[model samples]
Target: MRLIVKIMLLFPVLLYSQSNFEKAEKLFSQEKYALAKPIFENVIKENPNHLKALEYLGDIEGMNKSWDSAMFYYGKLKQLNPKEANYYYKYGGCLGMKAKDCNKFKALGMISDIKSSFEKAIQLNPNHIEARWALIELYLQLPGIVGGSERKAQKYANELLKISPVDGYLAKGHIAEYFERYKDAEKNYTKAIAIGGSKTTYQKLADLYKNKMNQPQRAKLVLETYQDKTKS
Candidate 1:
């Protein structure tokens, strides 16, 4: 009889938590993060292992650019669900953002952890496109003295091609630009434009024309075209 009474008492609390979570989720969906955060915090307070609340908190913190707080929530999520690729990816991304603003020594110390997190995310889910892209950029931007490798970047670009041709071309274009292969960069960027010309691709092309090719006239034309396209 006592156990039955305890079960009855617990049911209402569970229902209340579910209701609050649903309300918080609705707020979050509407991008009312400031309002939703406290509700999620309340839910987490009531149920420390509320996975959805934890994930949402991490996302909210990340969107707000509170990297350390985002990392804390994502790190908790990672501990709770280590097998989730998204958790590791977000965690690594938060770490990367934090490293960018930190001191050089601290940033250097974070490099291996950032790399491993992204690599682990990919290992867990090979089709994780964002993780692959992050890995590619990490390889491209880092010096060869560290773990950076143009060959690795190329390899990942090829992999991205298998997943998304447009992204692959963009990655190749970026790598080419990085190495001052202006002609190759222009070619790849052009290919990306031909495939699916986004505003970003147009901007990239315009920047290349202005900065690399010394063709301000062509860059201005490109920008004018972009404005025309976007306005319509």
Candidate 2:
């Protein structure tokens, strides 16, 4: 009789937990994170295997920049669903964000995790542009074993370039710059500028010639052309 009474008492708590989970899902879809987090937490407390709740709560924590909490939730979710591509990717992104808080001081772990996550995402969906872009940027920024390698960076860049003319120019220019192939860089930069002129491309090329390559005269010529075009 006592056991039956205890079970009956627990029924409303279970119902309430499930109801809160549904409400949380609705709120989360509507971008009401502030309202959804507590309900998700309640659901997790009641039923720890709530995989979607755990994943979304971790994502919310990441979006809020609550790194430690995000890591905690993602870690839990990963244990439950280790093979899920999104779980790995989001976990890597959270680590990347946390690394940024330290201004690259803790970048090694972040880079490793990011690389792993991107690899997993690509395996899951070979055509995922976001993961491909992530890998491209990672290799481009630190092309060596310490972070990445020039050859690998060039490979990814070339792959991305094949998809579109403008992206090709951008990728080739980055690879050229990485290898100190200044002439190639200049040519690709020019092509990129001609196809789609952005102030950033102008600035990058100008700085490269002026500072890295010790060609201030060439940099000045570029600035002059830019001014002329802008005036026109």
Candidate 3:
């Protein structure tokens, strides 16, 4: 997700493409996402090789949660510039969405595709932290019989810890949730929340405590916190 955000920020690079690009950038800066989209599309049609436009197109799709479209643009941008970490990272994101949307019968194939995309991204750039996180998330969500392993999750958690120790706690919390270790999950999540937390983190903790852990009071507290943040 951070990779997606980085790509989104890079979209402003197109502001250097003569005056039209600047116009689009102004619209974007003004939070006119829909208004800015067409101009960016026009830029792409004018110069398909425009890296910024392609990257931004992917970002726009990502912003809208159009996973399929995001994947398409990211794939094109990756071909044009295979070395950039974010392109590969966003591509992995697209695959992750596909995995989530796939039916149970198709889940295995989707997971394979998602894993492949992330592996490629990491291969191209090992420093792509989001790509690694994507892989870890998939690993935790997927089943063990098919390449998903608690062992691998722990490995990635360790790798992530090397980068940000606090975020490592969040990652481990996710792993605990996956393995059905509810108490451990809550503990890890509480640690993560004690640091700066996001809605995703809050929701996970709430769900685990509410449904899985049968600790409704704790869930309500976290949900209250989430609602407060959303309101403010």
- What are the candidates' C-alpha RMSDs? 2.5, 7.1, 8.8
Highest lDDT model number: 1
Q: Which is the leading candidate under TM-score?
A: 1
lDDT of 2 by residue, 64-98 (tens): 99988998888887789777777766777777677
Task: State the lDDT of candidate 1 residue by residue for 1-232, as single tens digits.
Answer: 9999999999999999999999999999999999999999999988999999999999999999999999999999989989999999999999998988899788889999999999899889988889988988888877788878999999988888888888888889989998999999999888888887798888898999999989999999988987898789
lDDT of 3 by residue, 82-136 (tens): 8877787788787777667778777677776677777787788765677778878
* Candidate 1, poorest ten consecutive residues by summed lDDT: 138-147
On the 0 to 100 scale, the lDDT of residue 155 in model 3 is 85
> Candidates' lDDT values, in order?
0.92, 0.78, 0.79
lDDT (Cα, 0-100) at 24 in candidate 3: 76
Candidate 1: global Cα-lDDT? 0.92
**Consecutive 10-residue window with the lowest summed lDDT within model 2:** 125-134
For model 3, state the Cα shift of residue 122 in Å: 2.8
The residue-level lDDT of candidate 2 at 178 comes to: 70
All candidates' TM-scores?
0.87, 0.61, 0.73
